[model samples]
Target: MSSLVKNIIRFILFIFFQHFVLDKISLHQMITPYVYFLFIIWLPFKMPRTWLMFIAFLLGFTLDSFRHQPGFHAAACVLIAYIKPFLVNMLIPQEGADTNYQEPSIKSMGGPLPYFIFIAVLCLLHNAWLFFLEAWQFGNIWYFLIKTILSTAISILLIFITELVFNRKQKFRTNTI
Candidate 1:
């Protein structure tokens, strides 16, 4: 029920789903849905940057171990983790940065707009970096761009569906003076 316990469970589940299920799905070899990054996005808003990066690295490394892709995933994860705070600040704004916001969700981050933007930017960045690294020596910019765009789109859709299905809106109480 606690944040720590919930996050631990999430970490495990995301990794399992990613490696065992999503990883096995080869959709035309271009649309690899990466819902694993959802774990990083779902982390508590107030979590320390160091811990966020560490967890992201761990998650990516674990995935790398399964997929045997060197450190591409790890690097992408760390990059996204590093920029997450800035993105959150920019998207949520000062007045909306409420302390009660536990994590980045449709309800917690306010409404669907901010939340959608937040997820889209992060997913795009992650997919771009990942596909760029994967296609580093290929020298085909068009290929890299196409793969990145397509993968990012699929990942974003999967993340949205997962959030809608699994995440529940937390009810908040307002005190009147």
Candidate 2:
């Protein structure tokens, strides 16, 4: 299947799962797991930055619609999307980066550490911005930090499990002309 088709399917599934399943699960007031961001994280490595931010905005806006929040998710999504390429470059490095990496899966990233760091950092940024926006008053910094940390941890776990379940190990190509 083409990357376009696969991404489209993933977009639909992520939205559906987030809205119908994850959003409904009230594990705690401060620990809502957000796996929808996984859709953005799973995008092809070379996708255009503009397209990445646009898609992230759309995904977040869609989730905001479900949650009845105005642009909160959109803001966080765009922020993380903006930082994703930088994180990828910093963690993976130019020499280690592969053009054929269709997605940021553990196998494609060559191991779990880089992939985990990539996802964990993005998740932290997303959750921190999200909770901060939700609590714009800045009433309690400690509470805000705790919420961000807990949510990020849960989100990271969900992302890792999803990658393990759905990501296939592809053989890396060595012959680069």
Candidate 3:
């Protein structure tokens, strides 16, 4: 399938899952496990950096509109979009890359280790920023820190599980990194 089609499908799924599913399944007093940012992670590495941030803003705004959170998600999403390329490049050195590839996964990354670690880092950053912003002004430092850690860990695990179950890499091929 074309990258455009894949991204469209992913966007739709993310909106539905985040709004109707994940958003509704919050753990009472705990932070929501937000795996929606994985959509940005799955985007092609070769996608234009500007377009990535634009789409990230759009995606976050769309989700915010649904949840009525205004600019919170938008800001977090833009941050994720902004840092994605650099994180990917760091995780998988460009000089070591063997092809003008697209998307991210064990296949495109030429190994499971780099892709998984790369995505984990990005997800951690994304969730930490998101939760911290939401918890801003709250004076309970321990609560804020623990919630961020728990929520971020849960979000990352959910993302990893979703990718493994979906096997998104089946659509991409990269023999070398």
Best by TM-score: 1
Q: Write the per-residue lDDT of candidate 3 for residues 20-63, one digit (tens) a residue.
A: 99878858566668888888888877788899999999999999
Model 2 per-residue lDDT at 66: 81
| Alpha carbon lDDT of each predicted model | 0.86, 0.85, 0.79
C-alpha RMSD values across all candidates: 2.1, 1.7, 2.7
Shift of residue 70 alpha carbon in model 3, Å: 0.5
Clashes of each: 0, 0, 3
**In model 2, where is the ten-residue run with the lowest total lDDT?**
167-176
User: Residue 32 in candidate 1 has what lDDT?
Assistant: 84
Give the least accurate 10-residue stretch of model 1, judged by summed lDDT. 168-177
Q: How do the candidates rank by TM-score, highest first?
A: 1, 2, 3
Which candidate order results from sorting by lDDT in descending order? 1, 2, 3
Candidate 3 residue-wise lDDT at 11: 98
Query: What TM value does model 3 have?
Result: 0.88
Give candidate 1's error at residue 114 in angstroms.
Answer: 0.9
C-alpha root-mean-square deviation, candidate 1:
2.1
Model 3 whole-model lDDT (C-alpha atoms): 0.79
